[model samples]
Target: MSNILVVDDESSVLSAFQDLLGSGGHTVATARRAEAALELLKADPFDLVVMDICLLGMDGLEALRRIKEQQPTLPVIVMTGHGTMQTAIEATKLGAFDYHLKPFDPAEMLAAIDKALESTRLSRSQVVLDPETTAAVAGDAIIGRSPGMQQVYMAIGRVAATEATVLIRGESGTGKELVARAIHQHSRRAARPLLVVNCVAIPDTLLESELFGYERGAFTGATARKTGKLEHASGGTVFLDEIGDVSLGIQAKVLRVLQERCFERLGGKETVHVDVRVLAATNRDLEEAIAEGTFREDLYHRLNVVTIHVPPLRERREDIPRLVDYFLERYARELNTDKPPVAPDAHRLLQESLWPGNVRQLAHCIQRALIFTRGYPIQAGDLPLPGEVGSDRAAVSGLGDQGLGELVRRYLATYTGDRAHEAFIEQAEKLLISEALRRAGGNQTHAARLLGLSRPTLHAKIQKHKLHADTDRQAR
Candidate 1:
């Protein structure tokens, strides 16, 4: 049930709304005034806000303004007994989900409530969508020197040596399919096509036809006889992505193809045999899916013959430096710019990032930095760690109780985006110098070299940033 906030001055109307929504299985909070509702809103996020147009003290219009200012994407519904068509138009302009007159249809209001909640959930995270373009999936182009990748490298080595069924598991964007392609590239079947089917992407009905092609006149819209992925991948490997999502019916057929080494076309009665290796990848737990009855147990056992789970990028912090260098060079080449390596502080923060979206998110972050930097040496402050909240919430994430000063400096220095990145680098350099000096026992010369700057330059930066005096260190 969705949590909804209802604001109205009339006790009777509020009670009636509570009775209607509570019976429909929704948790409702009734507020007498806009102040009470605003306080409640600040305490916790609500799915939908229902407000009376004529609120006491603070009108609903003002409350709506404050709500939108705080969270532009939040859905609000306006209810008024004094409803005119003009009120509805104004509410729409202010991003209201719907405007309901007093004594409106309880079912229609409830339906609107459902629509808003569903939309809000989907709008928040890009990670909810599967990402597939990480280095592991980039054929042989992705280069990494991290030790964590050694396991994946070894798996690819073992997988390449066989035509047996292989199961690759990892979180979204972990590059499971990359391992699959590496297997194909090393296999004897490298010359043949490596067919791919994203089991989660296509509709279940269409996926069956996608795997085993339908013949002309087999089903409606079967324009002509077409070979299935199994036939196309004969003498090669066929990759089935998101295998955990496959229907039980489809899983049984897949089992038959694996055991018999053949499958009949959708329209034809005759069985056609094909020599093909199967590679399956998924982010979901097939063991749990089988227990839940969504996946077939026998199919899971068959696919688990050679299971390889690729770890997420955050689990491999050692890889960030190598990935940064690789991305800088690759993107530089692609963009036809000088490949200036990232500065040390920038590299430090990048390595420290806990990439929830894994390599795909990292690649996207780097790509944005590269384009945003425009042929300049990427700085540490240029990093983006947009939080899980509103995508536009803040540039540098707070990192849960991180220093306010650090967050502020990081946010401001995020992108010279408009000015040259050199300007932001200069500001960041001063901050680093002061930090290093504070740690270096007030030794200016030592701090200068530690920061890769000349003593004279450091002295000028000290004066510019107005560093605190600690002159007694000279006598030490």
Candidate 2:
């Protein structure tokens, strides 16, 4: 049985914990004040501590600071009858494992204690965090040797061994999810499930029920009781991809889960407590979202405990040769064909080209090139890319040496855009379409011919870029 210390000013609170925890096969010690709790802590070894914010002598926050000073790794759960955002944030920053409202659910309290004990057990293990060796710890799906990637590996090594909430910031397709997986793979909860919830893929209406689950009749089509990602992950990890897309309402609930380890399902009265670590990724700037009032500041702080920024492929072009070889070998084995040689010019072009889609795009390009490369070696001409279109090149011949695509590629190579690929493509497409429409005197047919695109394709592009109405107004 694990030894637990219960500290509170109220006699009933102490008594309730004794009865609740005692039945759960744990030995409990009670302290009426902060001094008493500290005395007990100094005198004996306890697995966990549950303390109240308001005490007879020193306040709980002060006592929490002292406890952490003496036992840095000890997990402390602080509760208050009166809760405020500042208090909650302060408790978390001061290293409290969790902070809850007073008269918290008994089940939630019990779950918190269990998690603390489990974390202690895991932390006590002899496993060490070694940066150079941690890549192998996750089985090498993350292949990179550049300084940028090396820093990423080191961050994973340092953060994986702890229960810190990680916020991975990177452009799309930069393998943010892969970094999340690597963190989970090296964690104490590696044997458990690593559940993923793509925030952008799921609609805002269904995201709440999807994450916190729901009762049998929570909403239409809710025919059966469902376990949410958080509950399902139990002792594992939950990776929230595109986390910036989460709605404000769902963001509040997510903050609760990260803070108190408890959440109630939709249309369910009982709270479902869990012990899940959170790892979230997003291409959007959460700080910007917060300033715009679309995202919660408190939730941002809770998730930003340990930030891991994954560098895009362009920042680490030196690793292209290694990554190319890895992808080529894998695809060759998968296709059951001999690995084709990559011409030196092809490799040079790949390393120099601006990869908007990062590593993921490169891997798919290799696979596609391998399929149609015929014979053996793959050359620069064999690569099928938008920049290689001769028809479009003829259209922008008026621009002299480089076309609009080349200009855009050069701009992307030199610029630092947080959402570079998407923003760059959108801006370039708009500029090209606008220039064409201007040259054609806003005639759709003439503009389409000038750009060497069919009428339907040009119209669709115009609509996609919302240039039809604006350009028509300019033409008039």
Candidate 3:
């Protein structure tokens, strides 16, 4: 549970938040004014702050500025019933994690709180490079002693202090985001916010506005000015994942930001200047994309100032055992169960598997094993079946050799149910949605586009199938 401080003049508002957040297992402290909130903060540590803009004695914006000055990494959510475009912009400039109108939906507020907490964790928590030091630590760690991992560590150390833009390249589930976090955490801007923008997760139409804030009345439905991630992340670092997925127009704008450290907002004439370090990651081959004329060459050159390639898990087989052990221990704690030992045969099976999904797949496998084992030693039978372990390429090749008609005929011959057609459709839908989510890095918006479905539909299907997308380390 986290410690959250709520500052508002209204006693009812404070009591409502206290009840809402308290129900979520967070320790909530209420203060009638910003001054009291600041005093509480000075006396005790808080994981987050939720304050109103019109607090008596001292306003919320001033408190926000002071809080950021005292603790730069502490995330605060600013709320106001009299919110204006200027208030939102000022709050963002003062480093508020988010701004909300009064009487906001409890679910959205909780989601914002969770996002802010996660952001704080990623920025403040240290990413240990030594595998030996990881088992005892509760946070994230890059666990591997292989030569590939060693080189990666060296590269992060050598370039983290510098201002050069870094491009982290790796296949899906290879921990590219971990490298980005390590760089930000060890850099001169470690105390500053590290804003992560998943390019593929956001649609192209919205991506521009997300990076560059929109001016008031810039387009239809533009009710107020909105500050973008780039502007908010000024004086910090912005980790752009799947940078290659950005369109040519957005690429040119980003190129300008890198080249000049300035860009105009959508429909605004003023050129805003920002000082931010850019770290980009992508699983796609930029050279191939450039050749196809879908990616900009100049932008590629700019982002490639420093390159760090994360090797796929198959290339570093020796590290698999360590990774497995780490996940087993980590998930056991999260599952709130005694750590179970891996059977000799189970260990062998894991070591010999192709691991097409790499570390993320292994983590999910271990988590599943722990849940099913029920305090018993984990065995190979608890793991995913052999047919579930290979890459998409292997599956497609097998399908081609068998042909669709023959495959269906074989399944029909073995089937005793009359609802075979419905079963096949359901199975196909589940697999498609799962693979799409995996390819999209657990981004529901992008996965919906890939599957030719709306976001809500995709979300419902995911819920229906009880599928969990590996968002943290997958497609990094």
* Winning candidate number (lDDT): 3
Give a tens-digit lDDT track for model 3, residues 57-102. Answer: 8899999999999999888988999988789878987888877887
What does the lDDT read for residue 267 in candidate 1? 74
* Clashes (candidate 3): 0
- How do all models score by TM-score? 0.52, 0.56, 0.80
What's the C-alpha lDDT at position 401 in model 3? 74
Clashing pairs in 3: none
In angstroms, the error of model 3 at 359 is 0.7
Model 2: which residue pairs collide?
none
Going through the candidates in the order shown, the clash numbers are 2, 0, 0
Cα lDDT tens digits, model 1, 45-153, are: 7878889989889988888878877875566778888866466546644556556777677876776667557545433312111123333322134345556567777
Q: What are the lDDT scores of the predictions, listed in order?
A: 0.71, 0.77, 0.84
Clashing pairs in 1: 136-178, 346-380
Model 1 bad stretches (over 4 Å): 1-139, 145-147, 387-476
